[model samples]
Target: MRALTHLRSLLGSILEKKGAAWPDKATIEPPKDKQFGDMACNVAMLTAGKLGMKPRDLAEVLKSELLAADPALSKVEVAGPGFLNVTFAPAFWQKTVEEVLEVKHCFGKFNLGRGRKVQVEFVSANPTGPLHIGHGRGAAVGDCVARILRAMDYEVSTEYYINDAGRQMRLLGESIWVRCLELLKKPVTYPEDWYKGEYIIDLARELLTLKGSALCDLPPAEGQDICYEYGMKSILDGIKKDLADFRVEHQVWFSEKSLVAAGAVERTLEDLKSRGLAYEDDGAAWMDTTRYGDDKNRVLRKSTGELTYFASDIAYHADKYARGFNTVVDIWGADHHGYVPRMKAAVQALGRDADDLKVILVQLVNLLRGGEQIAMSTRAGQFETLADVCAEVGVDAARFMFLSRKSDSHLDFDLDLVKQQSMDNPVYYVQYAHARICSLFAKAAERGVAMPECSPALLARLDTPEDLDLMRLMEQYPDTLANAAQTLSPHVVSFYLRELAGLLHRYYSANPVLAASDEDLMRARMLMLAAVAEVVRSGLELLGVSAPEKM
Candidate 1:
């Protein structure tokens, strides 16, 4: 919890004398190739350009300044190309681990955004059908974004913008109703492009029970719209159940129906007109988004007077801003990438800063069995569900697998890897490390051995190279959290878990924790173990995965 000691002073000496501020970012990067040092920074070199001094010379000055500020520095060498490779004393690294223990699973949860209100709208898949595998990826990524922002002390509202008023919803209702009429042995006409998924047939069954024979009297083709509406609701209910089974929750299910009913969509168009960002053109209402750096103009309403998707989006974003969110994030699939420019333009057209709204587009998820791709279509009810995935593997395995890759990258969801529950699985590896630690504690207790407190001076006992390596990683956790937030990549936390788990597994295998009763040694190592526990626990929590004390 202590401020980064000597590095701050060294940088301060250079900047304060020059009547400036210390560089806002002083990263403690592992030497790119690892031979440079445990931690390295180019602050001195970064400042050299501003200070009118050679970078090497600046590093030399900063080295002396650093040692003077804190004796924790074992060595500070100015490497080639003006890099400052820093070696901290063994005790310094050890104490970092102990701090992790003290903080428990709360380690690395930062308040970067303070208490600002933020809204994350993701996985707004139309209520017309169940979520497909692709939707699952967005669901996980979007949910994690909200989780991380909340962890960083932001008041985040996780919402789902249901497209209940769209063409898709209407089509869905028709599909289900047509299927129901077919089941009732009545004359029916199904649309060629109607939903063909078995879920539609299942939804028809639900409607049969809800409305019974009353639907039999309505003309088949005529009542299809009503049936479609009924089906959309039934499908949405099923979608909610699937998401619930996956442990994902939303604060709001803001419907497009609400937008249209409240006149918000029309009102937004008027708002744009008042700002001169909109105009009537060629049977279409166009937004001059190119003026604001978009690729071209966007249509808000068709010349036919029907509202366009862009129009609804404008109203949606306006509602977001009106709700007073400091930040608004939209998570959409990769195919929606083209929509980003105009959406941002819409926010700006509505007179809100584009920067206030952020959009994250997650790439597709290709479900694979063996090495071959698995074809899953929710409309066909042919794909796997998150609920099915959870039941097959587990909540932890499902979550970890979903989180193991970057959102912007395509993920191959492998049932074999997730179901095996082996060391090859990263989730099991981390969990096993945690379980191993628990076993160690159980054994230690059985031996009538008690863990001693880490004295303020006990860190000095941790003087091994491996011990120092673990500490170096510990110091980077805060940066890891910040980097993940800034990049909107939750997979970084996934990477961190594997890295820390590797360290702990290696340390446990090589060292004998019970070799001696040396209180200082035992206390130091135990504290490090506790710190490892805290980090793994905190990391799993971020992904909404549980870290069990037992495997």
Candidate 2:
């Protein structure tokens, strides 16, 4: 980081001295091949034309300026067209060990967000049935994104938009009512679209104990309404518990019904109408979404005087902005990808920038066991619930597996592999690396080999390729986390942890730490291992996965 900062400063100073306009940003990245250098910069190639100098000639000048500004740079070579590959003195890498040790678990945090107020809404599954494995993926992705943003110093508010006012809730109520009638041994007809989950029968039995058979005495509509309200609340309660168990706690549970009751939906429609963005056509209100890139105008209200689902969503988004959030992120199922443009258009019509509303479409999860796909259906209540999967593989494994890929890609969660205690299981591998480090330290203590204090002088003794590779990866943590937050994806965290763990395992097999006779080398290796362990723990924490000291 210091090297890049110094390079940027030197480039700007040299540009100003040459009476040339300096670029606002410069790309200074660590080279992929270690032989290239500790860091590489392409500022010269990028700005050569602007300065009217040949790329290599410009790079030579910047390289000289950078070396003069930072004596820690051992060498700077111009490679290819104009890339400046830089090598840092050994002391620079050594200093990073002490720095990471001093910071401990907070090593990967970056201030890139600058405290931007953002809200992340994910896994807002309706209060209709138990959350399945698909919802599990969204929960993990959304929660990790929120965690990464917070790590980047964003003021993030996590939310779950409770879709409590939709047709699903009505169906849930009717389902429960019919189940109740069945329990009462009364003749009843069931709708084909009604929920068929066994939980409805369970709910009916519970309702029997509370309301008894007296509910049957009321008019059918009244009884169903009573069931709808009670069923919605009960299912929502279950949903809350399931999320809490999965370590996903939302700061807000915004209810859709509340918007209708508070007249927010009507007010939003009125505001759009006042802006000439909404019009009535044949007794139905329409939004001019096509004006903002939608495929066609969308219906806001039907001729029957019923607001469309899109209408409620627009009002909800308006509420999100009114709550003072500068950015609002919605994590929806992958099936909703087509819904993105329409929602963005609605935000524009509401007088807010479309970019302020970001949507992440999470793909489905296919559960596999014994090399065969398991069938699932939420309506029939025969799907693998998130809670059940967690119970089988444990929370750490479940969270890690769900976040192991891009959210938009389908994940075939192999139950057998993740539950293994071998290298085949990534969660186990990473946690084992941490546990191995802890065990090594414990054994060292038993042998009266105390960990010496960290210092540049001792750490400089580490010169092997393995040692340098570990330090390089650890240093990339802040950048990797920033990328994850900027992209709104948590898969980066999982990938980083796995790579770091692989390096640690390789180092453990090749090096002799406590057994080494040289005191300085042993201390340096121990300090390095400790830093690696802390980094692994920190990365795991970001993914909401456990880093156990013991397997």
Candidate 3:
């Protein structure tokens, strides 16, 4: 990262000398082809038109200036008509190990956000049932994204939006009440559309034990209300426990009912009507979502005097903006893909940029066992809960596999494969790399060799290709965190750790640390490996996975 900063500043000064403005689109990154150079830049192409010179000719001028100005650059070549490919001296790369040792756990942190507030609301499933695998994926992604932003110095708050005011809650209560009647040996007509899950019977039994048969003798409406309150509280408590077990925590639990109770929903509708964004037609209130690129206007209130879900959503988001969040992120299931445009339009109607509201849609997970798909249906309640999966595999494996790919891509969570201790399991492979390094330190200490203090003279011994590769990857951590934060993707960190772990595993196998002939060389290798373990641990922490000292 320091190398990148230095290159950007040096290029800006060179452009100043040439009397040309710096181009904002210029980029400096590692070359795809290692033979080209260590780092490649396109400043020449970006600024050539302004300077009235050919790209290759401008590259030549920049190359000459670079070699004269920076002694750290070992080679500067003008390649392929416009690109500047530069390689740094070995000493420059070796200094990265010292930087890691000096900072330790703070190695990858940055001040990119400058204390901007961000709100990430995720896995806000209605409390009608337990969480299934689809919700698990959203939970992993949302929590990891929040963690990545926090590492970049963003002030982040995570929330769970409770849909407790909707018909779903009413149905949950009726389902439990019917089951309670059956438990009391009373003849009841169970609706075909009611929720069917063993958990409903369990909740009925719990309510019966607490309130006794008196609950069954009450009026149907009164019994349903009592059942609704008890069911919502019990199910929500279980959801909290399951999420905590998955290492996901929410700072706020916002209730949709609260919006209606506080008259926020009515106030929001009035605000829209004042702006001419709302109009009544056919005895119903409508929002002109078409004004902001929606295909059709959206309904805010029905003719029956009942507010639609969109009305409450508008009020909820208005409250979010009023809370001073610079950005609001919503994580939803892939089934909600069609709702994205309408929600964006609603945000625009509220006088905010559509980009200020970010939505991440997580695709479904196909649970498998030995290459066979396991069927799941949330409404029928014939599904595997998140707690079940964690109990079988583990919290670490579940979280890692949930983040193994982009949130929009479908994931096959093979239960048996994740439990294996072989290299086929990604979590095991990365954790083993850290464990192996810790073992190496233990072996060295037994033979009376303590880790050497990191110094320029000592690190000069780490000139092997393996040592430099590890250092290069470690130097890219801060950049990886920044990219993940900007793109709102935590899968980037998962991919980075796998690559870093692969390099470290190969290095561990081919090189000898304690058995080396030279004492200083052994000490140098030990220090480098220690730095690598630190980076591996840091990356795994970002993914909410554990780094064990032993497998």
Candidate 4:
């Protein structure tokens, strides 16, 4: 990040001297091959035509000026048509390691967000059922995104939107009541659309255990109400426990019922009506979401005097804005991708920016056992829950696998592969790199060798290609983090760790650390290894995975 800033500053100064406008910052990048240089710039290529100079000639002038501006720049060469290849002195590279030590755990953090309030609402699955594998993917992706945003300096709020006021909860109540009647050997007719999962039966048994046979004698309507309250609390509590076990946490558990009780839905409807964004249609209220790019107008309230889910959602989003968040992000399943436009329209209707509400769609997960897809256990008669997957593969492996792919792509989760301890498993590979470094420190302590103090002279002793290569990779971390945060993608971090681990493994294989013939060389290598281990620990923490000292 500092390299790019210095390059841009140089270009800005040169442009000012020539009374020309500064160019875009995006044009600067490192060369494809490390052999080319430490950094490269195309500013001369961008501004040469306006300056009435050939690109190559202009690059030569900028190269000389860059070399003269800072002693840290060892060499600046003109490459290709107009690229300025810049290499930092060995002393500069040593100072880079010192900077890493200075920040330590705070390494890779950025100020891109600058403390803007952002709310990320994800895995808000209905509280009527157990969280399945799809919800697991959403939970991992969403939580990692929130952590990365916080690292980027955003004041982030993570939330779970409980759908307690919906029809699903009512059906859940009815399902439990029917199960209760059947358990008592009473005649009962179950609805075709009601839940048939074994969990519903489990809830019914718990309800019976708590209330006894007295609940069986109440009027059907009163009995169902009792079932609804108990079932909702029990199922929601179970959901929270599952999420906690999986390391997915939420700062707030917002309830849909609370919105209705606070009259927020009604107030939002009135606000829309006053803004001329709502209308009466055949004894119902309609929102003109089409005006804001929805495919069609939507019903806000039905003719039966019931608010639609869309209306409740608008109220929920309005409440988010009332809490002073500059941005509201919703991570949803791929099936809800079509719901984005209407929600954005609702945001605008509530006097917020349409772009304030950003939605990310997570695709499906294909769970595999021994390379064959497994829908569910026929004996169990139910699909796998998030807790089940976590229990099978452990929390660290589950999270790394979930975030190993882009959110919108279908992910084939191979149980056999993730459980392996070899380098083929990315989570294992990265964790092994950290453990390798820890072992190195242990051996050093046994040999009475302490970590060398970082200084320009001491670190300059590392002049080999592998040493410089590792330095370049470590320095690229901040840029990689910024890219991931800007794109709202945490998968970049997964890819980064794997590559860094691979490089560390290769470098270790070629260089004998503890057995180096020169004591100074061993100490310098150990200090470098410490930097690598710190970075791996930091990156894994952002993804909410554990970095163990031993495999």
Please provide, for model 2 over 1-551, each residue's C-alpha lDDT reduced to its tens digit, 9 standing for 90 to 100.
Answer: 55566566766788788877666566788888879998888878878888899999999998888788877778999999999998877667666788789989878786888989999999999888888999999999999999999989999999999888867888888999999999999989997788888888898888889998999777888999988888888888988998999999799989899999999999999999998999999999999999999999999999999999999999999999989999999999989989999999999987889899988889989999999999998997789999899999988899999999999999999999999999988889999999999999999999888888888789989878788888878877877887898898899888888999999999999999987669899999999999999988899999998888788
The deviation in Å at residue 175 for candidate 2 is 0.8
Could you tell me how far off, in angstroms, the CA of residue 534 lies in candidate 4 after the best superposition? 0.7
Measured against the true structure, the TM-scores of the candidates, in listed sequence, are: 0.94, 0.97, 0.98, 0.95
**Which runs of model 1 end up more than 4 angstroms from their true locations?**
1-6, 18-28, 46-52, 219-222, 516-520
Model 3 scores worst on lDDT over the 10 consecutive residues at 187-196
Backbone clashes in candidate 1 total 4
Clash counts for all predictions: 4, 0, 0, 0
> Model 4: per-residue lDDT, tens digit, 12-120?
8977798768776437678888788888888888888889999899899988888888888899999888988888876666666777877987888979999999999
Give Cα distance to truth, residue 547, candidate 2, Å.
1.2
- Which RMSD does model 4 reach against the true structure? 2.1
> Which candidate gets the maximum lDDT versus the true structure?
3
Quick one: ranking by TM-score, best first? Answer: 3, 2, 4, 1
Backbone clashes (count) for model 3: 0
Candidate 2: residue 420 Cα off by (Å): 0.8
Angstrom error of the Cα, residue 161, model 4: value is 0.8
What's the true lDDT of residue 394 in model 2? Answer: 89
Q: Which stretches of candidate 3 lie over 4 Å from their true place?
A: none
Q: Candidate 2: where is the Cα deviation over 4 Å?
A: 24-26
